[model samples]
Target: MAEEEKTDRIEKRRRQSPKGEERRAEILAAALRRFAEDGYQNAAIGDIARDVGLSLPGLLHHFPTKVDLLLAILAKQDIDSADFIGHFRSDLRSLLKGMVDIFRRNAGMIEVVRAFAILNAESLMKDHPAKTWFLNRTARMQNDIAVTFERAIAEGSIDGGVDAMAMAAELIAMMDGLQMLWLRQPDRFDMVGGLEAYVNRLLTSLGLEH
Candidate 1:
């Protein structure tokens, strides 16, 4: 009887653990949708809680605060992106291709892409909780692209006259602008194709065969 009880208790804990994780994922998904549609400042925690079928206090028990939930969502986005790409390619042509591939993948996940577009723009506010997060993310992306460009330049694959940091900034800006336009009229924008064309032009300017 004692052994049976112990086995049942272990089984119960195993089931409850997955349930807890599933509920947390549900909360994050709901919070992401709310933040995407309303922006962080305008999105209410109560609405998020209701969306996940949890009371405010119950939601708080998981995330503690709205900012905590927002940060968690952002972290999850980073993890998902990293998982999708694995390590970024070091060669200029391959790296550029990877960027287009990422955009193509983003087209399939419109909700996640929309949330990122909305949240990134909203984080520009001085007092936004996610301001630092966006800033750091931008810096990291720029550094990655710049490093790849420098490597290509060193190997004579790209023009040594090209300013790596400047090009990195421009590429990031182009992608962000394209995302905003695409989000506004997704049916009309060929975001992936546009990016691929831009990359081909860049390679041509660098005297590299595509």
Candidate 2:
């Protein structure tokens, strides 16, 4: 009887495991909706569970807390960078192209951008998880852009005197600003054209007669 009980428990655990992941994703989806529809402070976990057809316990099983869910959603942006390389295939052009593709693909995740910025603006606190994660993530991306800038300079694709680190920071800042602006006016911003235009300006500044 003990062996049978153990076997039953194993089967039940297996059944619950997949359900746990699915339930967690559902919880996150609903949580994002609630956070978007009603400010994050106003959105409750129970309502998220109800929207996703999961019990509060099930949601908890997937995300230990609300912050965990929020972080997961934010991390989703990095996870969605699959087509990023295609944008910069023949130098920085590929990277720029990837930005256009990514912005288009991640338009929904743009909501996460607004939520984070809003929360961050509410407090200038430094040790918060959202702020830390976003800072680290953007820093990493900037470093990558700096590396790209360095390589382009070596290939004579861009100006050698331009500080890669500074350029990277400026580039990322421009992109982030564009993203927020685009969120507000998708029809007006033209992300693809804007990025291409920025690259052209950089090339022209580098004496490349673009």
Cα lDDT of model 1 by residue, 1-210, tens digit: 699999999999998998999999999999888888888889999999999889999999999999999999988878876633235555788878888988988999888888888889888888989999899989988888898889898998877999999999999998999898899999999899989999999889888877
- Model 2 C-alpha lDDT versus the unseen true structure: 0.70
Q: RMSD to the native, candidate 1? A: 2.1
Error of 1 at 4 (Å): 8.1
Clash totals for all models, in order?
0, 6
For model 1, the stretches where C-alpha displacement exceeds 4 angstroms are 1-11, 83-86
- In terms of TM-score, which candidate is strongest? 1
Stretches of candidate 2 above 4 Å error? Answer: 39-42, 55-58, 82-90, 108-127, 207-210
**Candidate 2, residue 174: lDDT:** 80
User: Tens digit of lDDT per residue, candidate 2, span 18-115?
Assistant: 97777667676777777766656666878887787778887787787877887787767457653355346456756655666666666656666566
Which structure among the candidates has the greatest lDDT?
A: 1
Position 181, candidate 1: lDDT: 88
